[model samples]
Target: MSVKIILAGGGTGGHIFPAIAIANAIKKQQPDAEILFVGAKGRMEMEKVPQAGYEIKGIDIIGFNRSSLIKNIGLPFKLLRSFVQVRTIINQFKPDAVIGVGGYSSFPVLRFAQSKGIASFIHESNSFAGKANMMLGKKATKVFVASDGMEKFFPAQKIMITGNPVRASISLSSITKEEGLKYFGLETTKKTVLVVGGSLGAKSINEAIDAGLEEFEKNNLQLIWQTGKIYAEKAKTRAEGKFNVWVNEFISQMEHAYSAADVVISRAGAMAIAEICLVAKPAVFVPYPHAAEDHQTVNAKHLVEKHAGLMVKDNEAKEKLVSSIIALAKDEAKQNELKQHIAKLGVSDADTVIATEVLKLIKK
Candidate 1:
């Protein structure tokens, strides 16, 4: 009989992309697998999941507003309504297994699945676990993690250090640097810096880069900048008539950006780190200060401790980021050292490993 699986969770690209990678891996192994995605209504996944060519169901759910208590007055109603929606989805889908990839939407689906004795799995991509995932871990059949020491968050016996799944376009990219530069309408002779601040963009990073555009030009460095939506117009205005820079709200083909880059500036989100490590580029990270449990800093610190990457605090980016990138650009030896060290941490087949294990256990 064909197997059916439900992959749940997604608010950001970090969660959505990994879920898509896992779905693709499952399809590769089980051609007849009927896969479905579940995400919070109106969230990015509702759109991104379909773009990935998978069917998805969205629950009327939203996470609690930590910054503004008044914004959460309707939280209980939404949660209750989402559980009802989840029950209908579970009853109809009757999935063999449910996988949660760390988003508020996943909680209801996985909880209902576990309550029904359906095997449920979780993929926690952060060094510090989210509260929802921690609660879900107790009953989870398996918890896949990106790094070691996750036993403190999940049940020791139930954890697997499978690493975060990188999007295949990045992990398996064969695009040459010259071709990548040409794709971005940039010159191969100039060193290129790729700046990415996640799907929503990073305000501090954007402001810093904007302030340092002339400095980058002065150093003869080119840039391929993904400004996300909010900063797109301002970035375009800043880059006007500048042949050395390419600016876009989003770079749909990030493989090209990775190939073209001599150095990278990025937020330390799990998927971003995984992709950067896979690409083996020298990077300087600006971890978002407000991430839950300050996890982004923890992620960057782990690499910095191993000499795998450099970091600048978000608040310090405007003052220190440009100088750091310029310094690293001039130091080829440091670049190579970082490249070699970070490359060692990349896992190219995490999607396959997680998919195979989930399928194998369910079949038994």
Candidate 2:
């Protein structure tokens, strides 16, 4: 009998991509496995999953809005509706296992699956676990995590340190620096700073980089700036006639970006950190201060402590981000040190590890 699995998560590329990676790994190991993705309605996964050649079901789910209490007034209604939707999906898909990659959508689907006594798995990619994932971990058959010391969030015995799965295009890429530079229309002799603020863009990073465009040119450094969709127009206008900058809202080809980067400035989200590690680029992290429990900072701290990366606070970015990035760009020794240390943390085969374990549980 073919194994059926449900991969649930969304709201960001961080969650969506890892879920897809796991799905791909499972398909590779068990070609006959029927994989379905469940995500929040109107989220990126609805579009991205289909693009990845998988079927997806969307539930009417919304997370609590911590920034504004009034925005969450209807959250209870949405949650209730999502549970009903999850039940229908569960009844129809009848998955042998449900895997929850932390997101608002993961909760209802995994909760519904657990209630039905089906095996459920939780992948907590962050050092700081989400509240929903923590709650779901109680009954999860196995919990896959990116780093060590996740015992505080889940039952220690159920946890497996599988690392975060980076997309295959990046982790397995053979793209060279010269090819990457050509792809971005950049010169080989100039240092390239790849600025990314997650898939949605970081307003602070954008503003900081915009404020320092001249500094980059003065230092003979070039930029591959991903401004997210909201900042794209402004970033393009700002970089107009500037040969030192390449601005885009999203980078469709991240492998090229990784190859082109001499140093990276990024928000320290788990998936971003994972990709940076796999790419082995020295990075300056600007943790999103508003992330759940300031988890982004925790993710950055892990690297900083190990001398794998540097960090600037979100509030401090306007003054410090650009200078720090430029200084790091100029320092070859520090750059090489960060690169070698972070490379040790990279786990290129995490998808295979998680997939193999999931398949073993199914066979048992």
lDDT of 2 by residue, 248-330 (tens): 99998999999999999999999999999999999999999999999999999999999999999999999999999999999
Task: Compose the digit string of candidate 1's lDDT tens values, residues 314-337.
Answer: 999999999999999999999999
**Candidate 1 runs further than 4 Å off:** none
Which run of 10 residues does model 1 get worst, by summed lDDT?
A: 58-67
What are the Cα lDDT values of the candidates? 0.95, 0.95
Against the hidden true structure, what lDDT does model 2 obtain? 0.95
TM-score of each: 0.99, 0.99
